[model samples]
Structures are given as C-alpha cells and as structure tokens.
Target: MTSRSRPPRLRPLLLTVTLALALAAAGCGTEPAPDRVAGRSSSGDPAPDRAELEARASAAQIVAEHVWVTEAAGYALARQSVGVLGDDGFGSSYTAPDGGMLQLSVERRPHAEADCTDGSAAAGGSEPLWTCERDGEQWYRATESGHAYAREQGELVITVSGAREKVDRATLRSAARAAHRADDHELDQVLPPAGDASGRQPVERGDLPPMGDGAPNNDVGASG
Candidate 1:
C-alpha cells in the first residue's frame, strides 16, 4: 500500500480553514449589544435632551449679564460702554472712572461628544482666582491683560472675563456665581435673533491686549 500524505498546499488550506472557524466561533461567543439607545452609553447615561440644551443656551444670557463691564465690583456702565447678547455669546466693555479699562464677556457652545470636563485658565499659566464652592460648582480665575473665571454646568461652559487694573479674582468669581439659567422669554429679549446683523461683536481673548510677561495668554479667552 502506498503511504498516504496530504499535499503541502492542501495542509496549508486546511490550517487556514481551521483558523477561520475558530475566529467565527469567538465572534459568536462575544457579548451581546448593550441595552441602550438614543445616544445613551452602555453605562446608561443618556445624552442631553434637546429642550435641556435649549435651556442651557438660554442660560447664556445669565453669563452675559453677570460678566459685563458694568457688573464689575467698582465700575459703572460707561457712556461708551457696550453690551450685546448674540445667539451664542455676549460681550461688554467700559472705561473706568480713573481711566482704566474693563471688558467682560461670556460665550456658550454645545457640549462636545467627547470630554465635557470644565477647563482651567491656569492651564495657560495664569493662577486660580477663587477658593470656594456653591451648589457643587467650583469657580476659577486666571489673568492675562485682565482677569477671568470659568465654570461648566451640565451641558454648558460659561466664562466671565474682566479686564482692568481693578478687576480682581474675587470679582471674577462673583461674576461666575451670578450666572444662572435664564428663562426663554428672558433669553428672547436679550439675545438677538439667530441671523441679526446688529449685535455686540464677540470679544475674543485674543482681541484683548496681551498681559505683561505673557505666559500663555490665559486659557479663559483661548479655551471656549
């Protein structure tokens, strides 16, 4: 009887088939899909609701009012001062009585899909402004040409900036504290329509002059 042996190519093909079968079996034994839906995670945290997001957008008005130059601790609204609320942000500026200048602003955007943690101005080399907490919210402040504080609420990040000699960390934190959710009617009155041409131009951190010994231009303005 002739000795029987598999062809070398046939052996390789058999090995390949075995490997493919093993892989298919492994896949078949994998865990089932998570029992969740509609932007929810396997851990069961649902994405923010549309109405909730709209409410947060309305709350941008609170940041707008509280972070105005006129809202500074020792400043009054100047004649040339301007404060306007756009659909997504607010900006205000004023000249102090002693010739100093103060500009305060706040902007809001929807939370991103990944990483919704509150950012810090210290990341830009400025220092933290306050050391307290309210209703589980911690406020922060940093300096560039001025001072600013930023905080994150459920689905919104609010930042308040005050630029002037007298604008202190405490004042900025207070401004942060004053920010609250505003009602729809209030937001409608303060914020311009989505396509309005006349509104206070958003004052970006870069728009302000750089601080002395500029260490990174303060994260408040740079970070959204």
Candidate 2:
C-alpha cells in the first residue's frame, strides 16, 4: 500500500522539549532563556541554538519537530508532563488552579473521516469515539466518557482534551487551534534541563576512610 502524505521529520527542532516542567510550575512553564543549546549573538544578546534557528533539519529519535504546544485562558503547561507520545509524537498536560487538567498530543499518524468509525481516530482503538463532527479543518469527537478536538496538520494529528467537568468543548477547540510547533523560546521552557555528562569522578562518600584507599569509617568515638 502507498504511504499517505506526511511531513518529513524536522531535525534539531527541540534540543528536546521534555517540558523539563520544574522550570515552569506556573504560567506555561518557565521563561528561562534557551540557555543550554543557544549561544550569545554578536550583539551580546542570547540567541537560539545556531543549529535550531539556522541549520536545516536532520532526522533524530526525538523528532522534536512533531512537538506542539498550546495556550488556553487559565491553563499552564505542566512541564514535567511533557513527553513523547508514540515514538516521537508529543504529549503534555496543562493545569488550572482548581486542579482541572487538559491533555494535548501530536502524533505522526493518519486519521480520516472513515477512521472515526473504524476506530483508528483514537489511541489505536482504546478511546471510545461515539460522536464525530467536522468543523472546518477540525474533527470534534466525543465518547461517553470524554470529548476532544482533533485536526490534521500535515502528517500529524494534533488533539486537545479534558474531563467534562474540567473543560468545555469551546475550550478544547480553542486549545487545538492554538496548538503550534514549539518555537525556540518555548523549547527552552518545555525541555527539561540536561544532567551533567558521565565522567570517572565519583561522589565523595561520608563513610569512606579518609586515609585508606579501601576502608570503611568504623570509628564510633564520642557518640558511641
């Protein structure tokens, strides 16, 4: 069978937006500049990683090009929740003050009108899709349990959803429309900070004998 039209994966897109959520617990993640990947410009201003902003995309496992983000009235991105969907697909959660939540995901997959009935429109076939409506470029689907807004952007399907009590149809629709590829600034806020690379240096231990190469500090002098 011939493959459907899907956008070629863009490389060097995210530096990887793990949503590194701790940076942003409030307000759609943190506004910290993209420090890790970017460098200072000639004007001394911090600039995006030359590779992301200036170079052409190449393939990688992160496939950060598929990562998308959105904005809603009171929802803030839960950076820690940002993660890969299936393979390189993007997924994240947005939270509100009342403990309400919204989920947004972008997948490199296909969904047509027929998929709605064949059960391919949702998580393989796990999500019960009972209601389907086409509104302009979006396809609104509702199951007995929940509802969501979905649209096909290139070869990817972007979706937004929330519990019925937490969010309304209009809100989900707005989120889906607002969803866009994470830009350099957003990537910085969304991607988790990287850990220091591995080295031979070992952590100093409190129990190790200071004078001996391999001995335990067993002296319990004063206290014992």
Candidate 3:
C-alpha cells in the first residue's frame, strides 16, 4: 500500500539543464590564450622568436622580422608613421623636439657592400659633399648636411637616416647601433591590429569612376 506518485516528468528537463550548465562551466574553466597585440602590456617579457613573429606579422599581412626599432637620445617615435613599407618591409620615423626627423627603414633583400657613391643620387638636385666610410659592419654615408648608417643583418637591411641640421651625426650613429627587431611589446605599440575597424578608412568619393586605371578624373568638367 504505498501510493508513490511517479516522479515528475520535470526530471528529464532538469537533467538536460544540468548537462548544459556543466558544459558551460567546463568552457568557462579554460582560459583563453594571451593576446600579444593587445596594446602595451605591463608584463616584462622577452621578445618573441622568429616563428612567433611570423605568425603575428602574417596575421597583419606584413613581415614581422622586418619590424625594427631604434632609440635615439632625444628623438621620439612618430607613432603615426610606424607603417609597412613595400609589400612587407617596415618603415618608421622619429622626431626631435627641434623639428628634426630620423627615419628607420628595414627590408628583406641581399645587401652587398656597395660604394657610397651608388646611393649618392638619393641626395637630390645639387651634388652634396659626399663622404663614405666603413665603420665595423655598417656602411656610413654622410653628405655635407645629412648622414645615414646602413647595415646588413642576415637577409635584412636596416638603415637610420637624419638631417644634419637637426639630428646630429652622433645621434644618428647611436640610433643605428641600437636598431634591432621589435619585440611583442614593441609590435603592440607600433602596429595597429589586423583589420582594425577603428583605423581611418580611405574616403570613398561618389564622383570616382570605378573603371579604367582607377585614376581620379581631373579633366576639369565645366567648373574649374
């Protein structure tokens, strides 16, 4: 004479809920991998290896190994100018307080010791009093007003250049000496995230004809 009511059908529903809850708990227990490009981090860590750099760079469609940074005595990095050069090369500029500019360029190309005269044409219109010398592994090239130090490390060519009027020769040399591949922290500070929507996008003009060579038609129509 035991009149035991059958267990409530709600038991099945309770079991399902419990299973889902367990799964969610399990998922929450596991931590996500740390993000290396999440802006400047306070943690002191060593620079990442080439394989890691390649992964990070590949995500941003650039060459990670090409990203180099240098510290000059009084020059500060121009954050806006830290950008990719041709294809996957790296280029950045530093500015001094007195309106001086120091440029750092890194590229993956075989660099043979060439006479400084070969690059003299880069000076510009007038011929500059050019002087070239070898300082250790660096090819130091100097004009009457400006100077640049370029060195080859493996498959990369790193150069530090500045105007003599503002940045001193010693400062430029110091920077070149310090130039090295960027670490994870530097990468975070220098490069914008891959496909960062927050970045400024190129403005789309309605007048642009999306045909031909895609050049803007400036053939002056009626209005000057």
Q: Return the candidate ranking by lDDT, descending.
A: 3, 2, 1
Cα lDDT tens digits, model 2, 98-213, are 65566777878654423443333356676544556666667676655466777777778777776665578887787878788876655545555443112112358889976767
Ranking by TM-score: 3, 2, 1
Local accuracy of candidate 1 as per-residue lDDT tens digits, 101-211 = 333344455433322222233555564432222323543433334444555544445554454355556655655565544333333333333444332334456535566
TM-scores of the candidates are 0.35, 0.58, 0.61
For residues 1-224, write the lDDT of model 3, one tens digit per residue.
98522111111122323332342333421321133322234467666454654555666556766778777655666555555666667766666556666777887665344445443443555554566677766777766656678887776778787666666778878888988877677765566555552222235886678898777777776877
RMSD over all Cα atoms, model 1: 26.6
For each candidate, the alpha-carbon lDDT, in order, equals: 0.38, 0.57, 0.59
Candidate 2's TM-score: 0.58
Clashes of 1: 0
Q: What lDDT score is found at residue 169 in candidate 3?
A: 76
In candidate 1, position 41 carries an lDDT of 26
**Could you tell me how far off, in angstroms, the CA of residue 194 lies in candidate 1 after the best superposition?**
15
lDDT comparison, 2 vs 3, better candidate: 3
